[model samples]
Target: MNASAPQQSNSTPLCYSINSPPFTYNHPIASAYYSSIFTLLGLPSNLIAFIVLIKSFKEARSRSRSFFLIFLGGLVVTDFMGLLVTGCITVSFHITHFNWRNLDPHCHFCNFMGMSMVFYGLCPLMLGAAMAVERFTGINCPFTRTSSQTKGRPISMVLLVWFTAGCVALLPLMGVGGYHIQKPGSWCFFLISYKGNDQIFSLIFSVVGLTSIAVSFLLNTVSVVTLIRVCCGQDRTQRRRDHEVEMMVQLILIMVIASICWCPLLIFIAQTVLSEADLQVRYLLLWLRFATWNQILDPWVYILFRRSVLRRISPRSDWSRSSIMTLYPTLRETIRRLTSSSLELGEMDEMGKSNVTAPPTLKP
Candidate 1:
């Protein structure tokens, strides 16, 4: 019996290991439903945003464009790409309800998904931070403004963002951080299951990414408050300030929406890392759904809040700054303000009524 007992115990463990069902919280129906919704809704909104951003870029050639216009355009481009890659792949996986890992245990598809998701997701956070810093500096140190608002500067910044994100995404393949198929098996991300340097890398990445986003959100909030106070001031002469205020409001709204979509998931990941707890499939899916929802919401957010500086300059194919000046009083005021702040009210009237060339204050 003693000899038989040892054999039985070993067999029991083997049987349990082989027969036990794996933990899975796959809500395939929900995932498919949301993925469809995201595709249907997100595509059109992002396309419109792309058109608007392109128009803004075209406008930059003739007007004194701000870095904000460039930064916002870059952001839209990134989001658009993200929606295309992540959204489509996710929809495919969810609709089929198939775990690719079952066929290919290494989950190359998941790795690819993770790489694209991390790259595009992190880009916005970093870009948002950059935009906030630029706006803060511009508001506080307008005199120190250099030619940094030029197209070259923004292009350089965008390149840097892409380069940084590319490096981060590659780390998983290099073995520091890693990607794995999340349960429901349709999605993938930084592998929380890895230990040592891999875990440390993931933790540090989360902390830095979340911190950058939080700081951007906070800075934007402060900027909005300051602009609100400025806008409420009785001085009607600060119409340029009013325009600035309007643009800042749009930016603030975007930041807030981004925070809503991302902060909870980030917080959850941070807690999971610190606590060293097993990640639940349901929690991950819920948060991930929220994150993906941002892709759908991003462009629409810009459109809903569009006004003044952030508005589409013109729909006309022959649109030009001179033509825009004729169409928008704000543009005329902005051009006149740039040419000469000391221009009398009568001078503004004359400029408004005439075909005045847009003075370079085309602050995008």
Candidate 2:
């Protein structure tokens, strides 16, 4: 891993070890620049999004709305915490020129960074998976109403997710795995330099995270297809299902964006474990930055796809409407469909049909 000469002249200073590699920044300029910008931009946006989600939760009239707001709020909170813990530390280290690995071995800061990394990093990913699973089984699958659909389910699911992430984060402290200062020494994570429980945990983390993302993608695809079928088949004479289709499409887009941002880093970590290859420190740091982008981008996805927010922000002028239609026709149509009362009437008609079809005058 040393990129410098191992041998040196005897005349070299006594305080300096001949074998020591030259100190280098872990792509300091880029890391500092991007981390600062992302933190600045992400913090306020996530905070506002969290507030909006809370308001949405309060006003939610349907089970679907509650489900989405709960999960979305959890995701926003996770991202906000991530930016606070990781981003602040990263920026401080880069700005102060403090190398974390050089700190005393017994320092609590190392442990703090490791635990924070594991918990916050895993939390949002797992929450996203939980959201996807809930949507898939509850909405897409054919099942009767049951006691499991209580309002407390979201709270239970959120608690379960954090508990699982906490357990994983504690593994290194328990000695089942190891945490070490990674490239650039501003952050720590599951050690990629060893083979053993550390490697095992790393592989599990990578597999589980990537598998969850892939499953979300697959299930969303299936849901979209099923919705399309319903629109074209038995529901053909009914009004267009654009609202449902648009929302499902947005969900898929969010999943794809998250996977794109995080998958490369996970894959690289797995590869490093299996191959034991010596990689450039700067290269790994760059990939880590990519993974961190998910924290910055997630809130924006919620804002952009939110119907109420869009309605409030969209201008009513003819020129603006025309420009919106020209630039984002699908989004314009989705908003139009969302505001339509026809969909509500159709639902009422369907319910009435169900009642009319029931047998009457049953003798007891």
Candidate 3:
């Protein structure tokens, strides 16, 4: 071998090393604090979402109700997963105590958690897209319902969402695209890097993310248009139309929020791929972290605004029972007497009819 060749090979490897110094002490401190805040926000919101959805599942069997519940459940699951993975990474980095090279176990855990977080994060959006499509089909095509009206479509949509999310997440494990543990740390992410086939991975992620956003936008738009046309110049009852409009509005809003939260991250990824400016890349990454926080916000929006979800939690009897009992201590007795009187009237009518038909039995 030529004497100079070894020197050139050594320099090539040096260029690949990520020498970006640690983020400033203040910056890391701020990020760690923010991560804690996000964790706290996500945990409670997900708990509420889980409870609301479980209650909804117990009460109703309609397609709309079932789909909404499934959507909320997926949201809670993803948010919790994100919180777990992201919070762990933040905590590890905050104290400056991690030794990536020595701790093989933490490295493996980081990789698994990172992949899971990405997988779950994408799962809810895919489910939301499926939901919009189901709603559109149900409203626009009445015959489709006549053929199969037992909530099959919504369930199928939910299954498809989960399957698609699993496939997307497994892409990394299959070696099509893989996550990397950050240098001198156990923190793993899908962020752009010079190592491995990062460019290809980044491209693939951007394409998938943007395509999902576009589909959501299209589906939501069509649903809104159909809802408007159905509600306007119609002879249907005002209350029924209003309810339908409200549901459509809620679905559209959900899609819009998902798109708004995820779109920036996709655009930033694409920009990072095309730009060579380090400052621009850093700024974009900062914003992308903010957008990821949107996952936490999505479930809370559903909990706070969706009337169907809220109504399932608070039944009409629940509202009236306490007040009625407080106002009249004998309310239970009154109800019992009314029920007994109705039963007695029915029994008397039955006996009189029997007597009329018992001509020969009168001798006995």
Candidate 4:
């Protein structure tokens, strides 16, 4: 991972540790174009999500709904900032190709960038898991879901995730992990290594990231299944028509997107670190690229899945008269069966009162 050494992959460093000429853009047009596209797409989506969340927060009639919205806002803020910070630096690098050694003599800038990458990278995953836990508890033990009982609890959870991720990102500075200049020299990340502190750091990152994904998947599955059964079963009740449906729909999409985007990188890190194989920079870059898609895709769930937007997208969709109908009723039904029947009985998040229906038929 040293800069002086010849890297095994086809990646070309922007500058070497030894004396060298000032760097210039390696793939100026290609890098600029792609980075621009990424920024353009991600920025607008997150902004829209932010705007929508603000409106929802103001209009939230229940404490539980407000609590859940805080998580959504945290996610949008994290994604928006992540895209803004990383994209700007990456774009400048592609355009200027500044010498890393010359511009970042003490590795301060490199370390900062490296920290930003990790902080932004893990925050979303962690927030997703936290949100799933919030929902799962709200649905299963509505009365005991203390997260919404007090306003401070939800905000504190968001801050806790941030602190945890920030600390993990800073471990390299503490000598527990190491961040190195990576691939084409445009970005820096913790390298996958089997060495002393590095091996521990890599494994920790892998375990934390993978565990967050797993928890989100498992809990979200149970929450969704439980809600489906409560809503569609012969004993349907007010839970089905609750405003929590909005959050549930969005949470499920977030889980699915995060799972798809992040698993490859997390698993790859674990595999290479454990196997003692030569690091493949190309594969790491590939997985990182996939992870970037999480930023672009996540906010769209908020932007497009709004009740107003959903109604516009399909005015025919109805909740009370129908059994949770959507534009894709068949797809909905399939997921309902797969999730509801596949899992044992559970409860739904009682985040708020009914926002979708007049009132569904309730059991006495």
Q: Highest TM-score among the candidates is held by which one?
A: 4
Which 10 successive residues of model 4 have the least lDDT summed? 10-19
lDDT of each: 0.66, 0.69, 0.60, 0.80
Q: Which stretches of candidate 3 lie over 4 Å from their true place?
A: 1-30, 147-153, 183-186, 191-196, 237-239, 276-281, 308-364
Best by lDDT: 4
> Where in model 2 is the C-alpha error above 4 Å?
1-22, 26-30, 98-105, 236-247, 309-364
Residue pairs of candidate 1 with colliding backbone atoms: 64-362, 66-364
**Residue 107 of model 3, lDDT score:** 35
Q: Tens digit of lDDT per residue, candidate 1, span 148-248? A: 45567767877888898888887766656656555555566776533564576667668767877887877777777766555444344553554455457
Rank the candidate models, highest TM-score first.
4, 2, 1, 3
Query: Residue 81's C-alpha lDDT in candidate 1?
Result: 85
Candidate 2 per-residue lDDT, tens place, 1-364, comes to 0112211334322112211222455456455688788889889889988987788789876666677678788889989998999888878877887644355333357667878887887887788778777767655774754746876888789889889988888776666565555654566666664466767888877887788787788777777777755553432245444445545655776687789888888888888878878655666677777778888888888777765555667655333321323335576576557646667888999999888865678799
TM-score of 3: 0.70
- Looking at candidate 2, what is the lDDT of residue 261? 83
Q: Tens digits of per-residue lDDT for model 4 on 1-364?
A: 3332333452343223222334342543335676778888999999998998999899998876888889999999999999999899888987887878778755677777889999999999999999999999888777786543687888999999999999999887777766677757777777678877789999989999999999998998898888866665554345444567778998999999999999999999999999999887667877888899999999998888777787777777684344454545786687678667545333233323333456668879
Evaluation by lDDT, superior candidate among 1 and 3: 1
